[model samples]
Target chain A: MPDTPKRTVFYVSDGTGITAETLGHSLLAQFPEFDYDEVRAPFIDAPEKASDLVERIERVKRRTGLRPIVFSTLVQPAVVAVLHRAEAHIVDLFGTFLGPLERELGMPSTHAVGRFHGILDNRSYQRRIEAINFALSHDDGIIQDGTLDDANIILIGVSRSGKTPTSLYLAMQYAVKAANYPLIPEDFERKALPAPLKLHRAKLFGLTIAPERLAQIRQERRPNSVYASLENCRKEVEEALALMRREGIPWIDSTTKSIEEIAAVIMQHLQKMQKYADL
Target chain B: MPDTPKRTVFYVSDGTGITAETLGHSLLAQFPEFDYDEVRAPFIDAPEKASDLVERIERVKRRTGLRPIVFSTLVQPAVVAVLHRAEAHIVDLFGTFLGPLERELGMPSTHAVGRFHGILDNRSYQRRIEAINFALSHDDGIIQDGTLDDANIILIGVSRSGKTPTSLYLAMQYAVKAANYPLIPEDFERKALPAPLKLHRAKLFGLTIAPERLAQIRQERRPNSVYASLENCRKEVEEALALMRREGIPWIDSTTKSIEEIAAVIMQHLQKMQKYADL
Candidate 1:
């Protein structure tokens, strides 16, 4: 056996396990090297269920002769009891907030909601707030429309340039209103910023990615759109960048950066360039 | 002083804590009983940081004179040291996996993704799956130019009918791609499903809300769209529901149901009537 214990995350949520997946995936996405299995412990509603889950984990450990790390979000009397004998490294999500929550609610507990906050510079932080608003509000308009008034930073590129996923990540994580507009062939013909963008010249930022990568993402959505073509993607991206530079709008290449990395850079830029009252 | 012990949840991972929140929030949303202060022990990159975070949590316990619960994802030996003598409720995330994740990557997991598997059957369970699919897709085309094919059901009502928020909640939580089409005066005059929805006859569902509530939600956004008018709202909802009944399409008056409740009802309808693939 290896020197290290095997690790598994048990997200024993009260309902479906996807919510845990969202938080867990984002966390795991940060550490590429840390490999772990995901278990959605559904219907962990009662104290007995929590304790049972713990006991099961213990049995598995003794049977396999392997001690594994356990992560759980179970809040029940039985869960609290089971914790006493949990053999592996434990991360009790419910335990972290039991005090403040109990005080606030004046109850031993009934359900669970996690209150996790991250601190950032006020100005930079506000951009994230607006980003979330923008992302949630203007769905497709984010791509087809070029208005950046609500946007702290505008990501412009051709089809399949990794715009939508990146925008979503920023908005979901930081509440950043990251509006992304695709530079259609028509825009490329004149090679100018869309007229709506003329008013907000300073806040515009562009993103470009590898042509092959762009093709891959596009292939999944509209495999037949000419915009997804490598030649078309490359040409449009090149022209969009040139236009952004000529218009004096800054740009970032999204070729290698993770969604988190991209969001962090954009947040920093928005703070430095445009600190607007986003809400 | 509060009588309950100060509750603390130990959220641990080698990665950032986004995924934990997904599971954490679901539990919170479902239970709504347990409340806790949150501290994320994220970026426990190496064994040493794990030790430090473990120590800090212990200190928090000592300073507060309460035993803290630990939710951790410690996989390294150095990190396990901090867990020692912590005397906390430890829930390790990775403990569910019998072996290291690396060994399981290519291996088929023991768990089921629930496709084509025979299990206990219930209408509610079936609807939950359908609702989840609806929330997952959030098909924009359903709303574009007024096409409702993307939705298993069409919600027709004025603004503040809680259409958008409800649609979003269903889409995000259950993966249901519910589309809401605002029924307007023009819709009644044309006396048909809005132009876009005319084509999708089978998978259309409708909703109507109280005029006052419509005004409330609309007032928050545009505050002035004729769509917000209670009188207009009432007329449109009434007309649209009539048209739906005339066309042999069914609808629900959503004025009373919470978003989840509304989603639940729609899920039932979809399962019984529409043969939509869970794909």
Candidate 2:
């Protein structure tokens, strides 16, 4: 197979640039055959700033001989125009959705550049902060015995199976009070659920990983140690899966999955459980 | 003002529903004059699941006599058909971008659901995990003496002024190595930069908040205490802002800003610094 040409891509936003990058990644991921050199140009509010971005984009295009792709969420028409003047393929995210929304709502959009992620006074922001605090305090099974009642979800997994990052992502993104616990050697020896987790079985979600991948991840942290050995990884993962199966806890294989994917699955499970309980 | 009508909005996704919600929020936030009750329906991979979502949307429409808005990123054509049958507005994110992308790339997309956040094998995912780990270990200035050299950005702020969440968000989202330090009462008394932070002043970013807001936040944690008093909050913020101005360190007033906004500003600053260094 011939090598696919590398293209330059930029996520330009008047605010956090997260939404632009996220949607751009989703669009770009569809065509994984092409390699991309991605850049983030956030806080592009003024016309001057947009002109500067255009210069940067044009520079890249001239050097690469490929028209750069710009994914922008600039709400201001003037700034968007400045970016459009550049010799690139531009996707205006706000321009795409806000029109339809305005027609549906019977009003024009405020054309605000950064309203989506402003002000800590909003209820959602407060909830996210609270969730972050809860996650940090209860991380790694540091909770006092019998104090797991407040957690919306509890993650159980072998070390380096991606419980911690998943929990933090869930809390930060979704305001979910996620607590994670490592399935230690003692738990495997006991062949039973840990004492603190026994009563909260309903909230438990398990994570497992391929032994080879787990060994590689563990090796990065503890090189040349038995903890990073494939045999130990295989044993722990096998035992953890058996425990989750015996306990009827839903589990996911985290070896090839990202934290966002793992957290999403957990959230979907919780939503389903809540819906069922409500019914 | 009269009571605005409350509208129902759903973020429907074949995967995590994050992209849908993010773009939906950006659109909805433009019309904050109207109230919204938001729902997330993740993992709608099948036609049956899409049907269930339509049913829910119809139910909400019937109850309110207003059609609900559906923002979806479902990649499957059959499932998308099921959603199109619903009596509501549908914003198909993948449907919107995929065709343009496919045409540009001169190849049909794989139409793979949830590939944007699929695996941990990517360099971006690994960097994000490393950043998360770094943020956790160096949180609240817990690093040992002379150990702050690894930090890409150091945040200094009065307690609860949004430093910790901003640091974590920067790390999780942008793979930034962010370390935060709380400006304690001792620093305020000294009327000087903390000894540990003085050497790393080039990397410093300060956060300050309105005293009343700070008091309200602190009062929630420690009711009726001096630490939560408005006077103390005022004194600390004043001193912190003074220190930042005196030391010529850039700062932000975090009283109303969300963590995402703070992180964006910090990233923008970092980008400028990098560009300057390159020049």
Candidate 3:
């Protein structure tokens, strides 16, 4: 890590700042040699806030003797002009893309601020809210019977195997009807599929974690208990993987994967399955 | 809407494709006059897959008699080469920035793929997972005792005013420990802050919604109930806003705001409060 140069990076936006961060992070990740101290400065809509941000960047430059890099999605020109006072490289995301788009469309832009996240009382927003409510109601095998009927995807996993967060993410981000079921000792003892899960076999995706990692996670919740024991974790993971294999379910190890990765893999798997069905 | 030109846009990635979508969406939002038909292609790692993607783009061009716009974050050179076969404007995000970064760092990049969403057994990952767990356990005033002590922020809103999703999003995306409290009728009738919430006044953020919109949202849940009536919704929204103003708690209307916008506003407010405390 010490071989790389250290620099300050700021993602500034008039709104959520997610766009600036996504673009900046992707660009910085490409280098992989610089150690970045990144900070997110969202809602810099006013000139005062922009001036304050510039001052902070100047302070960093003075202290480190290295110019900071600022990735900005500030739509207002007045606010954006204030940021130029900072001793840093400015990567203006909106300024780079908006001109081309306006020319292509043959119309002037609305110059809207934070339009990406502004709420509309439209079907898309309603569907997202509905999906979120459905995910929460169906979480952790809650109301297992009729709930699976509407689920676009059902995740099956052992305890602490990254099911809940992934389910919520798919629902929130994509409006996918996602439900999760936990495999317990009783199901492992049966050596057969749970009766309820068998009905939704086609929608099932399994998540498994390394036994050692699972043990460590479980220990945090129930320290020194049998539920957190390595032996119990090993048995559960082995049985869970076997169950998924026996049923020919596509599974991924959640041990070293983020919820984003898990959800993407599941979405890709679904798309493939849908394409096969079309044929 | 028909006055504007129609364009087909693709967000392509070698990983989850989220960054592509986020950045692309912000860019497209700037051109609100144009109607965009968007597709997301994720996990296109292999050259074969890239070839298929190019073929799909070619098909779109032939059918629409217009060129498509492809926003790609594909890292591998071989895969990117195949994509050039398509008749489209390729906005190569990674290729555009990677070279400059490599030059600045004075080192060649690892050229690693999918590093953005890949999980490492590091403190950051653990913190995110822990935050998610905390948000879930502390959701909706569940186990109200001592839970607020750990929360970075507490969201207060009337029922269905978009509290839960915002809370969960903050936890997942930013690793902020957020909890939400519903403003029940009892508290509104009393015209005072809830006793427990008063203890953590500094961390409180309020969400209100337009009465008509709230009525529509509540109507979906209970078609004919008084709880979903316009009169009831109007009353609730009015009282909620009054209460927030009285408490001097910072508030935003969730009626025309996405969860992302709501969270950003709250975060900015928190930062301002923190800076004042520092002074």
Candidate 4:
């Protein structure tokens, strides 16, 4: 086989470029054989910035003897026209779909910039911030009276089974009010859900991990302690899984899953229960 | 006005569907004059799931007398084939770009599913989790000795000026170790930077919000108190801005900006300073 092909890829947009980058990454992940040098060109809402980006793309092309691959979500016509001058394979994320959408809807696009990620609606934005605050305050089983009533989902598992990160991700990404509780040894010994969680059974979701992984994670936090021992991890995980099964809480293994995947699973569970109708 | 062109929109994907939803939202935001009923169909990796989604789309189209719009990132050929059978305007996010990318790279895509948001790289995932922990521990100026040294960025601002949320966003989205410090009245009375922040001046970035917005946010947390008073808010903001300016720290107004916009601005600042070369 010839040497693995290499190319430069750019995720360019008028806003934060996060959508462009996210979609570009999903597309690129399908082709794992290629080596890509990724660059982010965000806030490129002006013709001058587009021109500068064109220059940079051209420089990469000249240096590599290959045209770069540009994934752009740019909406401005003038700025896009400037970028078209570059010697690159431009994947126009917006232009490709907007025309058909406009025809389908019988109207023209605003060609606006900074609208996707901006604080367009104050109420929704405030809701997201409030969700983040709720997640932070209610994290690690810190529950006040009637606080769990507001949570859209409550994650429960042994320590370091990946609750805090998932709670925050749910809050940040989808504005879901997620609180997490750790299933301590005391709860395991009693073979009953914590009193706070028992009152909110409908909102409870579980996360479990392989004992080895749990031990590895805990080792980093507290080495040479009973909490970090493999035997202890095994006992805790077994007890937690048994408790979740007994309580009929839906759960997924998080040992090899990202926070996004875990959160998506929990959201699907909520949807199935008809508790997240608006999500 | 033609019933605002009401129609259903679907974000379909083999994974979390977040990329499709994000890109679809950005595209639809440009055509803000129309009405949309958005739905998410995630984890549609198999042909059976795709067929189910197609059926749902057809039902929506039949009900509305218009074809539903679909934004999809499905990678499997069989799933894509099933989805194409739907009576809708399908925006194939991957199909449109992958063909050109394959030809450019002289290789076919792996056609694998669930790679983008999955935990593909364990080290990177762990880094993100660690970053989230760092953000939580160092939040609101809860700094221990030498803890600030590991931060990728330090956000300083008055309380409720959008520091905590911004720090958490940075950590969750980009694996950025962001720590935030509140510029309190004590620091302002001294008319100098906080002592801990004085040591790591280079990593410092400031956030300031409109006094009215700050007062409103504080009012939600503590009602009928001097801490939530508009006069106190105005004075605190003035002092914080003066201190940031005097200390030569760059800053942004977070009054109307989303956490994404704020994080993007901070990342750009770090890039300009050559501190975020890898990002």
Instruction: Please name the candidate that would achieve the greatest TM-score relative to the true structure.
Output: 4
> Between which residue pairs do clashes occur in model 4?
none
**Candidate 4 residue-wise lDDT, A1-279, digit = tens:** 866446889989998888888878888878766677778889998999999999999999988888899999999999999999999989898888899889988899998897785445456677888889999889998985456889999899999999999998888878899999999999999989988888889888899999999999899899999999999999999999999999999899998788888887787787788867676
TM-score per prediction, in order, is: 0.55, 0.87, 0.88, 0.96
**lDDT, each prediction:** 0.56, 0.85, 0.82, 0.88
Interface RMSD of 1: 11.3
Please report how far candidate 4 places residue B6 from its true position, in Å: 4.3
Off by over 4 Å in 3: A1-6, A31-33, A46-56, A76-86, A100-110, A118-122, A275-279, B1-7, B102-108, B119-121, B144-146, B189-192, B275-279
lDDT of each residue in A76-188, candidate 2, tens digit only: 99888898899987888888888988899898888877888654227777788988998888889889434999899999999988988888888888888889899988997
Q: Candidate 2 at B7: error in angstroms?
A: 5.7
Report the backbone clash tally of model 2.
0
Docking band of candidate 3: medium
| Winner on lDDT (2 vs 4) | 4
Best by lDDT: 4
Candidate 3 per-residue lDDT over residues A1-279, each given as its tens digit:
454445888889998898898788777766654677777798898999999999999998887778888989999989988987787888887776777766765778777888785532256666777778888988998864475888888899898888998998888777787889999989988988788788989989999999999999899888999999999999999999999999999999988888888888887787777732210
Q: What CAPRI-style quality would you assign to candidate 1?
A: incorrect
Which regions of candidate 1 are displaced past 4 Å? A1-107, A111-133, A136-157, A165-175, A181-207, A218-226, A235-279, B1-16, B26-91, B96-155, B159-180, B189-199, B222-226, B242-279
Per-model chain A TM:
0.68, 0.88, 0.85, 0.94
For model 1, report the TM-score of its A chain: 0.68
